[model samples]
Target: MTALKRRGTFAYFLVLVTMLLVWPMGVILMWAYTPWSKSVKVAITICLTILTVLTVHSVCYFRIMPS
Candidate 1:
C-alpha cells in the first residue's frame, strides 16, 4: 500500500482507540466527583477537557505525519 494509505489507517486506529477510552474516562470522571467535593469536580472537568483536546490533536497529527 501507499504511504498515505498507511497513515490513514494509523489515523483510523487512533480514532478507534480514543473512542474506546472516552466512555471509561467519562465514567471515572463522574465517579470522582460528588456533591460534597467541588474541587474534585473542577479538577476532573479540566482533566477531561484536556484529554479530549489531546486525543483530537493526536489523531490529526498522525494523519498529517509522513508515513
Candidate 2:
C-alpha cells in the first residue's frame, strides 16, 4: 500500500482502538457511579463524555484528512 493509504489505515485503527478502549471505561464509570459521591460520579461522567467526543472527532478527522 502507499504511504497515504497506510496512514489512513492507521488512523482508522486508532479510532477503533479509542472507541474500544473508551467503551469499557464508560461502562465501568456508569457502574461505579451508583451509590458513590456525587463529585466522583460527576468526574467520571465528564471523563467518559470527553473520551466519547474525542473518539468521534478522531474518526471524523481521519475520514476527512488528506491521506
Candidate 3:
C-alpha cells in the first residue's frame, strides 16, 4: 500500500512539473511569435531551444531512469 501511495504521489508530482513547464514554453513562444525585433526574437528562440533541450533531458532523467 505504501508503494502505491508513493507511486500516486510521484504521478501527481510529474503532472505538476509538466504543468509548470508548459506555462513558460507557452509564454516564450507567444512572445517569440509576436512582431518583435529580430534580435529579440533570436534571443528568445535561443532561450526556447535551450529550454526545450533541458526539458527533454529532465524528462529522460526523471521518467526514463527512475525505478
* Model 1: per-residue Cα lDDT over 1-67, one tens digit each: 9998887677655544543577455445344432337776567567767887898999999999999
Task: Give each model's whole-structure lDDT.
Answer: 0.63, 0.65, 0.64
TM-score of each: 0.48, 0.51, 0.44
What TM-score would you give candidate 2 relative to the actual structure? Answer: 0.51
1 or 2: which has the higher TM-score? 2
Winning candidate number (TM-score): 2
Which parts of model 1 are misplaced by more than 4 Å?
1-33
lDDT of 3 by residue, 1-67 (tens): 6997887677655544543577565445445434557786577557767878998999989997858
The C-alpha stretches of model 2 lying farther than 4 A from their native spots are 1-33
RMSD of each: 16.8, 16.0, 15.4
All candidates in order of lDDT, best leading: 2, 3, 1
Of the pair 1 and 3, which is ahead by TM-score? Answer: 1
Clashing residue pair totals per candidate (backbone < 3 A): 0, 0, 0
